[model samples]
Target: MKVLYVLLCCVVLCLNVLASSDEEDDKQLVEMERSADLENRKRLHTTNTFIKKHVKQRTVRGKITHFVCQNAVTMEKLTFMFALPEQNFNEDPVIQHAMELELQREMHEGLDLTEVEVADLAYHEKNMNDLGSDRRVMLKPDLALLILDIILNPTNYEHFDFIHTCRMIGLFWSVKDPTSFITNAEVTPDDNTCVIHHGTTVVKSFQYDDDSIVYVDNVTHKVLNPSFVLDLA
Candidate 1:
């Protein structure tokens, strides 16, 4: 009976020692994990600090070109008026083609005459808008006359010159017209004051007018000028 009790006590002592050793091992594993986490956090913070200290800041300079015309431009529908030189007005195919190329180079960018009917002088003009919008405009003989009248040789002299003078009298809708404009959730308008709105309008309408209208940039009205004016006469 004494031998049995002694063997039972030995077994109990061995089990207690094993339990204590297991607890110590668990504590060491937890400390090692905590040390690794602290090292990772320190490395992340150091990388962020290095980026903030060594990163270079850049500033972009924008050019602001103002209009020269001081002749109180009244708001109206966009219109241009000019008379073509008599020589280029005739229905010579070669001359017409040259005139078309000149107009494409000066006024219309990416202008392609997809269909040209020589008999009726009617054609379809596929063009790109300033905002990279694509449009195909069908121009009849009558409408072609109006467009050519303004864009053709502006000097109105005996010899042929590509540069022509034209008068533009109208308010152009820079933004989409109320009828066709789709609602954009991204555009947020400033509701703060009129000053912000006015500034935005001035920036949008810069160089809006053609070069024939505003000849020289006048310093007096440099703050707000919309047209590209020139005195060709």
Candidate 2:
């Protein structure tokens, strides 16, 4: 009984010492990594201001995007740019993406959105991104993000004096084409409304040659193009 007791005590002490040593080693590694990260962030700040202003970078693989508003008054339209560094540690190909974003500004009189309406809105937003899955273009949003509304007495349009459903979607787009898959797509206002499939995508230019084909180059299925022409009334 006495030998068994001593052996148990010895084992417990050994385990405690091993655990403490492992914990200290982990702490030291974490501290070193944090110091390195801080230095990298400082370097990034000094090196690029565009990313600092627009993107909230975290770790080497993640970024939090900010919306670039078109008009402060009517922020119905926006654009955004995401800079992805290649060689995260210096071996990957860095790519910068720019795209248009849309948000609706409606004037509903005493109308309350039902559960279905809210679900539909979420579905539409998700569908927008899903439609572009083939291009590996995904919008990674920030955790500490919010959508706030400001009541505006819009005088331009009659019959409405107060604003309720007003939320902004922000993005940025440029022409010096970053991605290889790109072409021009346009949605013109005809007698009827154009149901744009991917209006938020960055386009090269519109084709007057054939409205049926949105964007075409030397070959087929090689264009970052979409259609606003849907068979509707």
Candidate 3:
């Protein structure tokens, strides 16, 4: 009977020791987590404060064709006026594709037109998936303040040039060749804001009015810009 009691006491003592060890381990773990969270909070607060200081406040809208002096003296801004129809404003993809076709048509004045079925088949095959546009994306103002801020402020940017820029305006347009764009466009004061009467609705006009040419560190491929102000009203 005394031996049995001794054994029971030993087991209880062992369990108590184990429980205390487990509680200590849990307490350490909780402390470590609290320290990490506090550090993260500090970092996040600092980052938020830093970013708030440099954010730009002003905005300029509309598509821009530009004539900036090589020495960064006088920069000229010009935009064109287009009479876009109501249908073009509502169904955006149709309007976008139509613009590209218009560019091809303008560039290829003498080429024969393809049948609707053939063109549709080619388009569907090449573009299998369509990314639906959010109303916010369509509604985001083509504000030029971000470009202005980058030029004026230089934390992420070390170098910037006020280069001559022009736009052959259309809905879905890319620089034919950025290298060619660098030296190819001639900007006389007279035709800088040109009006090539490609007519409204049918011909679909393009405008280049603004002096906001976006450039990266060394690469010429641009991913984003505050270009093409969409006030198609």
Top-scoring candidate (lDDT): 3
TM-score of each: 0.25, 0.30, 0.29
Q: lDDT of all the models against the reference?
A: 0.26, 0.28, 0.29
lDDT of 3 at 128: 12
Q: What tens digits encode model 2's per-residue C-alpha lDDT throughout 1-233?
A: 99999999999999999999999999999999776554433323222332222233332112221222222322222221222221131222132111211111111112344545533432222222233231123232221121111112224323321111111112111111224222121233432111111235533222222323233332222443453122110
Regions more than 4 Å wrong, model 3:
56-144, 147-233
Task: Estimate, for each residue in 33-137, the C-alpha lDDT of model 3 and write its tens digit.
Answer: 776444433322322222222222111121222112233221111111111211122345454344434422332232233545223322111111111121112
Where does model 1 exceed 4 Å of error? Answer: 56-233
| Better model by TM-score: candidate 2 vs candidate 3 | 2
Provide the lDDT at 74 for model 3.
19
Candidate 1, 1-233: lDDT as tens digits: 99999999999999999999999999999999776444433322322222222221100000000000212211111110011111122345355334334422322222222323211232123211211121111111222332233434444433322111111111111121212211111111232111101112321211123422232222222334333322111
Model 1 residue 59 distance off true place after TM-score fit, in angstroms:
14
